[model samples]
Target: MLDWLIIGGGIHGTHAALRLTAQAGVAADRVRLLDPQPSLLARWTQCTGNVQMPFLRSPVVHHIGLSAFELFEFSRTPEGKRFAAFAPPYDRPAYALFQAHCHHLLTQHRLPELHIQSKAVGLHRMGERGWRVETPAGGLDARRVVLALGLSDQPAYPAWTAALASSGAPVRHVFDPNFRAAELGDWQQAVVFGGGISAAQLALALAARQPGTVTLLLPHPLRIHQFDSDPGWLGPKYMRAFEAERSLDRRRRMIREARHRGSVPKDVAQNLRLAAQRRELRLCEAQVLDAQPTDAHRIQLHLSPGDSLETDCLLLATGFDGRRPGGAWLDAAVATYELPIAPCGYPVVSRALRWARGLYVMGPLAELELGPTARNIAGARKAADRLAQVAERRRTGHQVTAA
Candidate 1:
């Protein structure tokens, strides 16, 4: 049996595995990261590349490495200084620089050897032994399991997209794993939906490629916020009050309110405005009420305020679904194991992100405990810190492990 089996080899899972081996003294051979992708952070790379995002919204310090300042220190290295590493305001690292730093860490620690390219379909307790995770290849036994699943698998499509697709219109979500921006085909006009950073970046990219041929349709005026949530949520400034709250419903509300949903950063917003002024991109502020295929190659989108648009391609940068991830397999596990969930159907995990005995959660699952930043890179670091403490206590012969 493995010492730790992490399901999902994205940012959260990679960070968890690194923390276990590097800080908790767990043998790298004993820890495994299970993901459907062939490599770690593949989905992250794909999604960011699809949008042509230049820099990350997160700061340079928020990375998957063992130390908080590792990325910052890397900036001073010869390789890191090759390109534009950090942006202004908050020193947000360029996407290329961030990925390079992550690659360095993964290679230095040999974390890729711990990866198992398989999807975890089922999970069940093994009584006193530990837990068994069911995959297509077979079942793997582990003393502990961390569900580090991300929201990438659950892309949120607008309601009108289904009908438009059925009518033979070209509509795609930017975050779809199979949706390649390079294969978007030659189109006279393209409509990029959503008002968030991804939509803005994608619109800018499309406009730059084909000036005066791209339109950004925003449901509302573009909201400008540097980060998704206030930086206070990362530390005890906002987290202290959040942790003191005993009500999960209230906590959910707090998270929703704290998140700056469908918003862009100041830099991105500024760039978008400049593109609009240059006539390279057209910005429209109105909700898409419905859409219909005007012909085989054209779609007429009915917008709010009695306006309509005809376009050859429609790209949705709409984010992921708000539903709990892991689908029916996880629902079955939750029912069979009787794991405690909040009223919103999210995991009610402990401070260490433990949901059940020997079972932990990260990403969206740990939101209630980690606060609004639970789905970001900083949350992964926070989770690693908590899990490291647990692993250290376990190493020292502590037995209080029940959640």
Candidate 2:
């Protein structure tokens, strides 16, 4: 029996595991973190590749530290800082520095307690106040659980993708495991889809890789704005306003407006334009109406304007569709004995983040309580604080229970 079982050992899992260890009064040996990957952030290798990301969109103060200045203080030391110092009063650290800091923190903490290299099979309530998690290795009894799954792995392909696949040449989404940028042999022309930072970065990556060029297809009439939402969304200025909203629909609308996921930065846009001007790339506002595979394995893209574009490949970079708790795993694991979920698909919880007897939700699922930033790195701290407060009360025999 384990004291805690944290699923998906990404950044959220890392922090939550540490906090859980502290709260449960258990050593690392007693805690278990189940992740499909051998190392943390295995999914983020592409986004943080040797790319020169000027500064993080997030603030420097918001970090995985006991104190806000912990990362800053660590930045002054040798292994502490990887990127150069931020020139003057800027509060944002270079993205490189942030990645480096994360590396240092994970290594320093020797995290990933009881790392399970297999995937989660499912989850179900065990006894009166515990959970029995099913995995490739079999069942493990846990006193608490946390979900840290991210959005990147689950790419949202438009329904037309399959219809397009029926075409002579099939289009592939960027998130496909078999999609390799290096082996794009003899394929000069390609169509890249989506309008988020991922799409922009992938376009830049693809453009950099080939002597040939790629076209970025967008739905919007104009190139989306960089840093589209206010940085203040991270702080209380906009967050409090969002929190004060009484209706979930109203709040979700705010999320839709503020979640500027696919916007490219100015530098990336410059690269795309330079590639275009040099005849290495083309940027267009045409949407992908349909897709199909040709006899020679090339993709045939049918545009909205009654025009057809044939390319060696079509990479859909569209982001994830709606995701909350409860999918196949939840369906398989959650028995009829657990607390009821809200209509929106997330576990209905108190302000402390607990869903049932010993089950808690930490990452994106916390949106109902933490608002729009629930999936961001900063939200980890807020979750930690809330869970920690409850842990303290429980330590003193408070016996916090589900509503």
Candidate 3:
């Protein structure tokens, strides 16, 4: 039996394992991280693969290492010196630098084996001691379980997606991992949806491949405006303001306003304009109403400037569902043992993010505990750190003699 069973081995699960073994004094062998991927950080390929972004929206302190400055300290070492310029604490760090810093730490750790290519089917609780996790490999008895699932589990296709899918169309939200962007061929026109940073990056990426062949569709007017995440909410100031509101309705409204609903930062905004100026990209304001297949080879999209359009392909950068992943794991687990699910389909977690019977949650699901940013990388660290402390306490309290 492992001391901790952390599901999802991306940044969240990795942090949980690292903090538990290295910092919290839990034996390394006692920690088990189970993820379906063959390696870590694979999900970022779809999200951040286009242009190498400089300047992370988050600061250096918000990273994967155990200590707050562990990333900074590692950056100065030989493996990390290449990224030292981006490590200046006072300045906003670069994405490439941050990514490199994280990779460097992963290398230093010599890649701990926490089981790869494993998907957790769900979980069941032992009578009192721990939880039982079902994996493709077999069953794992863990003293504590941490749900560190990432954004991939909850890809939020637009509402119209279901209608289109039911209509038996080639249409699909870009979040489908099977839909390979590189597989696209010579097409005269394609539409990339959304107005946020992702929309811009995808438009730029597609245009560079096909050249003057793609258009961007946004539901609203372009602002040439800069919208990084809210700075006030980074710490306690603005966060507490949202927290103080007792009503979930008010809290939801405040969260919406606090996050970037559909906007890009200054740098990304400029990059999109540059991509357009190169005559490879075009941006338009229009809403997508319905999409259906004209044939196996073509799709007709009904648009709501009150018109229609045809496209070779469509990409939806809309984001993910706050609800559970479209998988059997959540529903199966809930049904198997009767777990309490919030009306939103998210697990109602304690302030420490434990679900029921000592099973905990992290990442996007932990948003209610840590606030709106809980889906981001920094929030991953926070979730892992907190869960580690809880797991540590439980493990120490339960050591049994061979007698």
TM-score of each: 0.98, 0.85, 0.85
Model 2: per-residue Cα lDDT over 165-268, one tens digit each = 55545466666545554455545687778876666666666766764567878766444554546567767888888878777667677876787666765655
Off by over 4 Å in 1: 399-403
- Per-residue lDDT of candidate 1, residues 1-403 (tens digit): 9989999999999999999999998988899999999899899888888999889999878989888788888878887777546898878988888988888889999999999999988999999788999999999999999999899989999888888767767888999988989777878999999989999999999998999999999998989999999999989899999999999999999999999999999899999999999999999999888899988889999999899999988999999998999999899999998999999999998877899889999999999999999999999999888888888888888764544
Model 1 lDDT on a 0 to 1 scale: 0.91
TM-score, candidate 2, is 0.85
lDDT values of the candidates?
A: 0.91, 0.68, 0.71
Estimate, for each residue in 1-403, the C-alpha lDDT of model 3 and write its tens digit.
8777888877777877888887777887887778777777666644465323446556778788888887778777787787776623345566766778767766776444665577888677898888888877788898788888877746678876676666565555666666556565667678888877667777877877887888888878654434345666667888777666665556556665667767776666777778888887887788888877787656787888677777867678777665665268778887877776655566666766877765888887776667777777778877776776675665678532210
> Model 2: residues >4 Å from true position, as ranges?
22-26, 46-56, 62-66, 70-74, 80-82, 85-95, 164-170, 177-186, 222-229, 266-271, 332-335, 396-403
For each of the candidates, the C-alpha root-mean-square deviation to the true structure, in angstroms, is: 1.2, 3.4, 4.2
Where is model 3 more than 4 Å wrong at Cα? 50-56, 72-78, 81-95, 161-172, 223-229, 242-253, 306-308, 335-338, 391-403
Model 3 C-alpha lDDT versus the unseen true structure: 0.71
Which residue pairs collide in model 3, if any?
A: 55-94, 156-320
Q: After superposition, how far is residue 150 of candidate 2 from its true place, in Å?
A: 2.4
